[model samples]
Target: MATEELNAIEIEIARNRLSSIAEEVGSALIRTAYSPNIKDRRDCSAGLYAPDGTLISQAEHIPLHLGLMPTMIANAIAEYGAENIREGDVLMTNNPYIGGSHLPDVCVISPLFYDGELIALVATMAHHVDVGGIAPGSMATHATEIFQEGIRIPTMRLFAAGQIQSEVLALLMMNIRTAEKTRGDLIAQVSANRLGLRRIHELVDDWGVDGFHRACDSLLSYSERRTRAAITKLPDGTGTFTDYLEHNGLYAAEIPITATVTVAGDQVTVDLSETADQVDGAVNCSYAVARSCAAYVLKVLADPTLPSNAGLTRPIEVITRPGSLVHAEFPAPVAHGNTQTSQRVVDTIFGAFNEFTEHLVPAASSGSMSIVTIGGIDPKNGTYYSYVETYGGGQGANPDGPGASATHTHMSNTKNTPCEVIEREYPLRVERYEIVRNSGGSGLYRGGEGLRRSLTLTRGKATVVAGTSRVATRPWGLNGGGDGGPARVEARTNGEVRELESMGSLQVGVDGTVTIQTAGGGGYGEPEAGR
Candidate 1:
């Protein structure tokens, strides 16, 4: 009898197993990483790809990072030439123009070979605390060019032919403020990919190389079919919406992120060609980011149980113009683009989709990552230290119930750094850590509340960079609901208190205090009469 073809049960099992491999890769990266950004906050992603550079499966990690990996793999393969990628060779990159979201996020890809034939690739992307730029954390707010953001890595062999490239390694560590930490995290990424490669070998052995490839192809097609069916459920029409960034770091001007979502039959197109031009600040985003946000919105709106892969992207078409905020070109500073601007893109798409699915979509969420980076020497230990963390804000209110309070949503899903960890790791103290009550918008379903966090310098001067949003414009509510509170940043030095811009840098002298009050989510629906 001929071997049976793949059935629904077999396809489902293959999908789960593939996703399990990706999840294990993520777990290894977190447990072995050096920086709190990766270990504690969990700002990293892992995925498995077919030899032809298609996304097979990914761990449920940062949405922005996960959505951008397929292109990164394709670019890497093109630059290195598929025939040249041998066993034990790993490629790396973080240049936004070269299929990356930003500089701090580094992508590592390792090819898997079975019976002298390349079968698959395992990839991982992590946010290193430092990569050597104008700032200690490499996330400078006012940098006008990508060079100032950090060292841009092209598609090159980080590890060639089973040998670690020491020159490449030294060149990377030489530029960043936290060399040891960066090096440690990079090594952890390599190890994570190696672990994933080992698992892939085991899987291929169990199913045979041909059988494994067949399973991947079948699952990818299944995901596409499911996504197309979900799109057909929406009313065929056009929905347009626009959201704004309070300001890019260089100037105080409203930057618009607009999207016109058109759903025709079983296809969806998100047109972002109407967004503002690229600004002379670190707020510019790349094409990958725009595509990622658009795909993310559809993923959330579609079936909740849809398995994530390249197939999920098949039914969606994303349109963006070059030199625009959503699809910036080379050398455009985009440190804030990945974190701050990406959030607004998601909100804009959701806003447009809400026109047709009001009950399904939530009100606006905290439209920023509220990123803060602090670095200096620890006077007590005489060792250098750099800390980068993104604070949690309000999540949008949904029809099902109230929004989640003090949480990271959408493109970013990092956990808050524990107050105790902050103090123990660096020369600082958490002065205040509490929820800002009444910050969320009011309606039948209340939005989530933001957080109030204050940090005091215990000793030694430190440089502080704040890249936040939702200051001038507040999170929007829906159907007669009230808007949420605005974001605020302030500094108090030597008995003098002054307000701060949403995007800027400052020096925190000893005993000086910096406070950040994040924005809340938007409420959903009109308030009911009486109690």
Candidate 2:
């Protein structure tokens, strides 16, 4: 066989093997994780990267973490250089400033070695149940500083020389409310990494490492070429768009996130510098998180066929001003930036792109629909439980297809823990869980609808928490499409509703009935026009 043929074959083998490695890691995480967050809801991510900290491939994971992997790996190498790393060492961190989105999404880094030399890294990050913060579940929308978000673990070794770092593990276990579960997930992350390392070795044995290395590089180069071609197809011009966050939950001020999108010679630059400054709430975001959001949006709206490596990000440059809403400062709260601001950024970009390529972008989605966690025990068993569920609204209608109903459109790939799983795990009973039909806007492509779920406590008392939006400014439609409705929660004592608008953290208790009413998405083109 020709040398070129061998090289090409080897690279293809490596690329395929890398995807296989991700799948293995994801399976191990799902099977081992104890929390519904990881097991059922799948609020987790796993990926493989080259030795130089370039993301090669990711398992079927969320968009937020897929693009953010390079930053996470880059920080891991920055904190602990290659020389300091040992064979069994696994690093972990959740610092947003230091290449992370939020504290809840913890990144576990493991170095992979072939022929006794570091060739790659395997990583897995999950939304931990708790990480010791001002809030019980670390949703800390009230947080004014990074300290209030959750535990900040700089890049540190979870395992040193094949042995668990007991000191670090013990300190982490002692913090969160779900200590036992966190410990298991922590070790499970390493186990998943180990599994990937083993699979890579198997691939190396089948074919020489030379081919595998070539394949990784080829995959990236191919992706870059494809992404550049996609850029060339966009209309060459500059367009600006703006969108607003209802409030910082203060009923005080409405901040606007703006994007000036310039497409020049097959390149796009999204500048968010004109956006508003950081406000008094936890709505601020780190530069890495902001870029990650931009990257995610482009990947979704532009081309999912691209490799999603540095190559794909080459044609796109995201600019944000420091201390602005996009670039948050120290001691400034930013937990909601990952969830709330991410959607706003996407919408802003969509709004900009809508002018250039109207048919490409859809209407705005029901933004910021995160899970509300409320759980604890009275006198029954003293075994406190933490329960959280994601509530979603309608997705905006598109020119071709109507939006999905009662579903999380973007930034929400998680699933609601099943009724059987909820009952088996905690002292709770799901009374009502169904779609809120006809809530969609009337249009050519009817907008997606929202959902309504009711849960009743079978036990004594359980605390429930929530962080959702689209209740204030409904989803906006494109062309003449209609808007998505509002979103709110309801708590009842003896079947009588109590609070209508509340962000329940650990302050509220649920004894009997609790119902949550979510919103729907907006329509796209005018129904009459399309007709």
Candidate 3:
């Protein structure tokens, strides 16, 4: 039967099944992964795509990684001609210039076949702890160029014809600092794709191949219809808002990210042309990252219940200046771009969207990922170490109630490194982990509060590099609400305590303590009656 012949019930079933398959792939990778970053924090995403690289369904994962897979798949197919890719061949890449958010995020792509015909692509993007850069964690805060951030892997086959490429594995292992962990995570990704392929075959067996494809197409069209309907309800006008990054890693000057949202009939355009130019730091992001951020805001503001696919991005257009902070050129460092700038982009978009309709959008969120990278040697085990993580912050308040506290939001959805896992795996001790009272903004429905976590090194000395935002400016509240508290970081070494800048590098001696307090979310409505 033709794709248009698929009924609504049949299309919904098929669409949900495809999403389940993507969820299964993510579950398998998280269960068998080696690093805490993947297994504990779950910094990964899985999705299924059409042969032409149109997104079909994606597991509920990191927003930054979700929207970039289609582009990456197209790049992979371009590098290795479509005719060269086989059923069992798997391609991998982490080059930001080639549809990637950053260097540490390695993407794996596997093509699926049914009855000797190419049907779909199973892909996943996972954040590895290390990818062999100047810094131990591969997230150098002061890096001036992309090369200094980490090794850049171009589109290439890691597995061919159902067999692992030994030389390719060796080269990858040789470059990264954590060879064993990286290898295990890569294997986990491969396993996840294979599992997805097996599940797809089962799905095809249940519903004929043609029926399955038709259902996918129907689902895409349905989502597009729902999104357009939602868009038509908004007023036809322009809403503009600007957000600032605390500073790029190389300087103390504030960086601006502006968004102008135009709603005309049933379409919206997010223009970022007036934003700051690319800086000489590690916070510059690719156009892909900018698109992901804008797409996320539109998806949330629109019908979020609609299945996420290419359809959600159909009515939205994201335009960025070629050499702006949100669309950096080649050789620019982007280690912190995926984590830092992406959050600001989300805030800027939402700020603009709120002007169009006050009740539709929530208050500003924490507006930063609060990335901390530590690397050193363990004196007892003599093992080189690199630890990368981001702390959780508060969520923005809605019209109905207060926001949630100590959680991930927007472009970043990574879980915090559990104290037990950190103490067991690394030479560090979690001295204190608790919520900071009154950090949330004061309003009728107050925003969520941030958290405080202190860590002490127990082994050899280590170098710590951190990139954070919301220090110079607080998270903005909506309507008559109050702004949220800003984030802060400090280090206490050898009885001398000093506050650290938003982005900087420092040395932590054995027994030195580092404390970080994440930012709170913005409030909504007027202040409450008392306190």
Residue-wise C-alpha lDDT for candidate 1, range 1-531, written one tens digit per residue = 123447899998998899999999999999999988899999999999987679999999999999988987787788779998888899999878967888999999999999988989999999999887888788889999998988999888999989999999999888877888899999999999999999989998899977887898888888999999998988887889999998898878898889999999999999999999999999998898998998899988877678899989999999999999989997799999987999999999999988776587888988999998898777887767888989888888888888899999899988888999999888889999999999999989999999989999999999998878888889999877778888899998998999888888899889988898889999988898851
lDDT of each: 0.89, 0.76, 0.87
Q: In model 1, which range of ten residues has the least summed lDDT? A: 1-10
lDDT of 2 by residue, 379-435 (tens): 466755677666777888887899998776676677778889988887777898898
Candidate number of the best lDDT: 1
Task: Give the lDDT ranking, best first.
Answer: 1, 3, 2
Error of 1 at 279 (Å): 0.6
- In the range 1-531, model 3's lDDT, one tens digit per residue, is 454656777767878899999999999999999999999999999999888778999999999999777777777778778788887899899988766888999999999988888888899999999998888888888999998988888888999989999999999888887888999999999999999999988988987888778877888888888888888977778999988887888878878899999999889999999999999999999888888888888878876786789888899899999888998889999998987899999999988988778587888888888888787888888877777888888788878889889888888888888899999888888999998788888787888888888888998999888777787789888878888899998999998999988888889988898888888999998886884
Give the lDDT of residue 231 in candidate 3.
Answer: 85
Off by over 4 Å in 2: 1-14, 249-252, 493-496, 502-506, 510-512, 529-531
Q: Tell how far residue 506 is off in model 2, in angstroms.
A: 6.1
Error of 3 at 427 (Å): 0.4
Q: Where is the poorest 10-residue window by lDDT in model 2? A: 1-10
